[model samples]
Target: MTDQDAGPGPGRTPRLPPRWFVRSAWVVHRGYYRVTGGRRGLWRPQPDKWGTLLLRTTGRRSGQEHAVIVAYFEDGANLVTLAMNGWAAPEPAWWLNLRAEPDAAVVMRDGPRDVRAREAEGEERERHWATFRQLGTDVDGFSVRRPHTAVVVLEPR
Candidate 1:
C-alpha cells in the first residue's frame, strides 16, 4: 500500500506526525525559555530574516494558554504572519485559537506586548502577501497546496 493508503494496522485510522510535531515544538520552546531565563531562546537572533515572534493565545474551548514560535514581519505598528500549517491540510492550532480570542500577547526581541489579531482580506491580504513573497520565502509553493491561507495581522491594543 502507498504511504497515504497505509492505515494503523486494520481498524485504526492513519496517524500523522504534523500535528504531533506541533506539540513537540512547543515543548522544546518552553524548555529553552526556562533554561535561559528569557535572556536567550525567547526570540530569534537579530536581522530576523522573516523575523520571529512568540505568539501566546488562549485556547478557544479549553481556556488554556498556548504558545507558538511563529515567523513574522513587521508592518509599521502591526505584525504579520501566515496561518500556513507547514503547507498541511489543517490550519495551525494557534491560528484557530486566535479566531476564538483575538486578544493575545507576543514576545519579540525587544519585549512582550499585548496585541489583537485579525485576518487580512481582499486588497490588504494581497498587499501583505506580496511583501511575504518578495522576502524570498516559499509562500507560493506551500500556499498552493492548501485551499486557503490566512494572512494574520497583530496590532497592539
Candidate 2:
C-alpha cells in the first residue's frame, strides 16, 4: 500500500519512539533525579534545545504524589508543556492528575516552585503550539495519530 493508505500503520507515527522505550526512558530520567538528590536531570528551554522539568501532581484517587519529567518552555513565569503521552493516544497520567487537581509543582534546574496546571485554550494554545513548531517539534506529524493534544500551562500559585 502507498504511504498515505498506510494510515499510521500500527496507529503510531514511525518517527515517534516506541511506547516501551518511552516508558523506560521516563523511568531512567526519574531515577537520575533521585540518585543525584535532585541536582540534575532538569533544564530550561534554550534557543537550540527543548528544556525539561520534573512535574509533580497529586493523584486523584490515590492521594499520593506522582512525578513525571516533562519538556517545557517558559512564558514569563508560567511553564508550558504538551499533554502528550509520547505521541500515544492517551494523555499522560500526570496530565490527567493535573486535570483532576490543578494544584501542582515543578522542579527546574534553578529550583522547585508551586504552580497550578491548566489547559491552554483558544489563542493561548495556538501561540504555544507555534512555539513548539518553531522549536522543531513534529507537531503536525505526531498529532495526526492522536485525537487531541493539549497545551498545558503551569502558572505560579
Candidate 3:
C-alpha cells in the first residue's frame, strides 16, 4: 500500500522523525528564515491568503520550546489548524504537543500572538473544515477522515 493508504497498523503510529529528513528540512527552512531576516521568504506567498504562522509551544515532557509551520483558519475570534498530511493515520507530534500544553505562541507577518489550543468539535469542526477547503483546493476529503483528522483551534490566551 502507498504511504497514504498505510493507515495506522498494529504497533504503528504517526511520528515525525527520521533524523536525516528532519535535519535536512530544518537546514533549508533555517536558511530561508535567515535570508528573509525572519520577515518572509520560502514559505510565504506574495499575497498570502491562507494564514500561515510559526507556532511556538513548550514541550510537555522536556519543558523546552518547539516551533513548527502550520496553516491557520480564522474562526470568529480563534485560529484553527487542519492536521492533514498524505502519510499515516493518527496525529503528528505538533498536535500531540499542543494537546499536552495548550498554551502556545504564534508568529505571523502581523506580529506574535499568545494563543491556547483546543480541538474543535460538532458544528465548530464542520465550520472550520469548510473554511479550510475554501482556502485551498483539492482538500475536499479532509474532514471526512473523521475521528482521525482533527481541527485544532487556537484562540488568544
Model with the higher lDDT, candidate 2 or 3: 2
For all candidates in order, the CA lDDT equals 0.80, 0.87, 0.68
Cα error, candidate 3, residue 119 (Å): 0.5
List CA RMSD, all candidates.
Answer: 6.8, 3.1, 6.2
Ranking by lDDT: 2, 1, 3
- The sequence of per-residue lDDT tens digits that candidate 2 reaches over residues 1-157 is 5443454545544465567998899899999989999888887799856799999899989999999999999899899999988888887888889999999988899988999988999999999999998888877777876799999999999
Winner by lDDT between candidate 3 and candidate 1: 1
Return the lDDT, model 3, position 24. Answer: 71
For model 3, residues 109-128, the per-residue Cα lDDT tens digits are: 67788999899999988887
Model 2, which residues run further than 4 Å from truth?
1-14
Model 3 regions lying over 4 Å from their true place: 1-27, 42-48, 85-87, 142-147
Which has the higher lDDT value, candidate number 1 or candidate number 2? 2
Superposed by TM-score, candidate 1 places the C-alpha of residue 66 at a distance from the truth, in angstroms, of 0.9
- TM-scores for every predicted model: 0.77, 0.90, 0.71
Top-down TM-score ranking: 2, 1, 3
State the TM-score for model 1. 0.77
